[model samples]
Target: MSYDPRRPGEDKSQRAQTRERDDAQVEKAHRPDALILHEIIRREGEEEMRRTALALSLSGFSAGLTMGFSLIVPGVLKGHLPHEPWADLIVSMGYSIGFLIVVLGRQQLFTENTVTPILPLLTERTSGAFLRVVRLWSIVLVANIVATIVIASVLAHTDAFKPEVREAFAEISRHTIEDPFWTTVIKAVFAGWLIALMVWILPATGSAAPFIIILMTWLVSMCGLAHIVAGSVDAYYLVATGEIDLAKYVTGFFVPTLLGNVVGGVTLVSVLNFGQVAPDMEGQDRVGV
Candidate 1:
């Protein structure tokens, strides 16, 4: 039954229905907005920035070591599978394993810093803040590369893996480094964008974080996108085994991919994300004017 606006009170059933609808609307409205997510990730970035250099270095190394599994698993899959179209699809799933390990373990992966450290810089806009971000990026990127070198050397010299697996690894490495310099750089930009996007989404995803990490990384692999950290493992493995010279690895693979990733993450993802949220943040700062 409808009630007149002038009535002192509505019918009991109608009033209860209205209250329930109002409560539901309020609950929906209070759910986290984009600005809220931005703040959550920014706070996390601040916390990470506060950690010591040694701590960051160790964690970055561990992340690099862990990322090795992305290559190893795909190698194993390719080793076991017949030379068929479907094999590539199955092998790409292995690319996500290392990412899952690093992300869930909370280790410092360099690509992640492309988004995280930049958040603080965006907020502070100071020379010191910029330098701190540079320091973190330098430490993490170098540590990741060092770990890749160590692991690639071990894999190259030791008989730890099966012969078939080693062959598969070589095949994967060759395929990765064979891309033209400019092509690799272009692909790496996409890889960087996807990885940075993954970091931005994680805090909001909660329990689904693992699936998000896997899906994004899997796309990176399937699409043949270059990623600086994971690609380092593939590129350096070839170097360790004398398949590619140091100059080729540095000029052909490393430098271009590094520049591409930085451009993609910093320019494409972080800057755009901040731009989207900055206006609302500024308005929030002013009150009772």
Candidate 2:
């Protein structure tokens, strides 16, 4: 060991093998990167969706109840603010809280799931799986929206809200009534896009994703973006309180917002995500490889 200078060349191949083994050991010890996490989350999402279909009604009702925060938050915040535009921002932040919970908690949210299940269908799965996903999305979405409307109406009629909250609801209702149908639809499209983006990002971020979701969704609400399920609560509140006509709320707010959300999620986020991931997909022809 002390006279190694002249023998340095003797162990060259042995040293190289030792170094290679060391490198392999190091690589094995390293934590998983984004790609691995992505796969884990993708599979998790798929499994969640499968379970969600069976529990669709309960999930839809919970989504409705949770979505009511959208109406209540703005209404509550309006009481604190002096009838100014900035008050809307405060309320919108509150609205996003419910979404953050339902989504990050891995509870079934109708809109977000629309894009997820479709990805699997793009491959060679049976047509039945594709139809099942669609059926699940449609049922959950419809039930959620209906639940929101019903709850909102009850809250409005019962005067469960404080006087200040009632005033805020009325103020918020006026804006919905005043806006043109087309504008509501457009805003809803953008809102849905943001929500879908949140869904996409969540899989990549793991447990910490709720913060990102809260931020983006708050921005969506602050910017006056519309969301179908959440917005229905506000629309129905107007009808329940006798402040706005039911027909107008249905034709104007409900129809337009729902259409906009679908367009945003499916046409924007879902399609874009598919296009980005399509090239990377390999071994598709093989069965479950």
Candidate 3:
């Protein structure tokens, strides 16, 4: 959640003046290479693993509740915009709002954990490490989904939003279930890939972290890709509104998207990113991951 939280912040000018003029120092000042990025995330994963179950669950819940903004913002956009191709494109950009909040706030998002924890699990390759990853995944995913379900119910039943906004929410939620099972699965693959990639690059983004989050998340929405957490808010809203049955929501959206996201995140991003960094990472300090 932090870029070495124990370390104090240093001014860019102060670091440039104080550090020796060397290649290593130069690398430190600029973008971190893939290996450095891996270590940074791996340490983050280690720190996450050390968190108590309650802390992880609460953070995950907060992320899920906040993720509702992605749906609400886009719905608000749609309510204001005339229905047109270009308008949809502009509305998709609003989908980044929730992601900006979650990522910037350092909340426990399930998609992010797909890559962050796996680096250490790959290096250790021990039963304990594998169990730890599973534990984190289970806790975070459940907490996120439950929170989404609760928020969806609140949106569906309450008069908290304008009628136009609520209608827009229902209209957008329908698209998530309109896709066939395999089609949704395929779309979710790209969603998972991009999200994990966002986490991977974040450690190197310096002050551009917010821009990167918005850009990558916008790509997902613009491409109509499925994301487990973000899409859940939409899908669950339909179920709560009685527009779709629970069985259809689960079979059509939940199952396919979940499988696709896990496959895309763990296989495409986590395994491959670690594979590229493995040779350089060998025999290095364990760093207690």
**Best candidate, lDDT:** 3
lDDT tens readout by residue for model 1, 72-102: 9999999999999999999999999999999
Model 2 accuracy (lDDT, Cα): 0.73
Worst 10 residues of 1 by lDDT: 3-12
Clashing pairs in 2: none
How much is the lDDT of residue 167 in candidate 2?
A: 79
| Cα RMSD of predicted structure 2 | 5.8
Q: What ranking emerges by lDDT with the best candidate at the front?
A: 3, 1, 2
Alpha-carbon runs more than 4 Å astray in model 2: 1-45, 52-54, 84-86, 283-289
Measured against the true structure, the TM-scores of the candidates, in listed sequence, are 0.90, 0.80, 0.89
lDDT of 3 by residue, 134-166 (tens): 999999999999999988988899888889999
> For each candidate, how many residue pairs have backbone atoms clashing (under 3 Å)?
0, 0, 0
TM-score sort, best first: 1, 3, 2
Higher TM-score: candidate 2 or 3?
3
